[model samples]
Target: MIDVVAAILKQGDKILIARRKEGKSLGGYWEFPGGKIEEGESPEKSLIRELKEEMMIDIKVTEPFGENIHDYGDKKIRLIAFWGEIDSGEIVLKDHDCIEWVFPKDLHQYNFSPADVSFVEQLMK
Candidate 1:
């Protein structure tokens, strides 16, 4: 299984989510900002790197939102989620088609990937 880290980046009462670009896996779906964990890197390091690479933002990955393993038919992934806030830099999207700051209660409106949908439920609690 692939290990991935996602950031539940909070700014006030809102959290950041990105729309996957067309042609990518789970394309057109909204999900938390993060990517696969590379070899020899911790989840925090991977998330910090991914945010910089994908969103051009620096973040201090704080507390865990929790973890889940999901089967996506062809592949299964162990998703490690952390909720944090932006530490520095403005967001400049390099990968996703769009980005939005959504309140946890309203997250259900967006079409999120299955794994991130679970994260949303946790946030609402």
Candidate 2:
């Protein structure tokens, strides 16, 4: 199974969400910004690294928010999510096609990745 980490990055009352680039896996689906956890790295460390590498932003990972295991026909992933806040740097789009800051109640408007749906549900509640 692929091990992944995601950040519920917050700015005031809004949370950050990124859309996968077209032609990529889960293309056009929105997700919490993060990537696969490298070997030997803790989930929090992985999230910090991923946010930097993908979005060019440093984050302070706070508490664990939730986790889920999902199968997408050929691939299965264990996705771990954490509450986080951006600590520094401007946001840059390297891996994603677009990004948005949205209120939790408005998250339902975007089509999110299946693995990320659980986190969205938790946030909306």
Best by TM-score: 2
Supply candidate 2's per-residue lDDT for 118: 87
lDDT of 2 by residue, 18-42 (tens): 9999988889999999999999999
Candidate 1, residue 48: the lDDT equals 97
Candidate 2: worst-modelled 10 consecutive residues by lDDT: 20-29
Candidate 1 lDDT by residue in tens digits, 51-75? 9999988999888889999999899
The TM-score measured for candidate 2 stands at: 0.98
Per-model CA lDDT versus the true structure: 0.92, 0.95
TM-score of 1: 0.96
Candidate 1's C-alpha runs over 4 A off are none
Model 1: lDDT to the true structure = 0.92
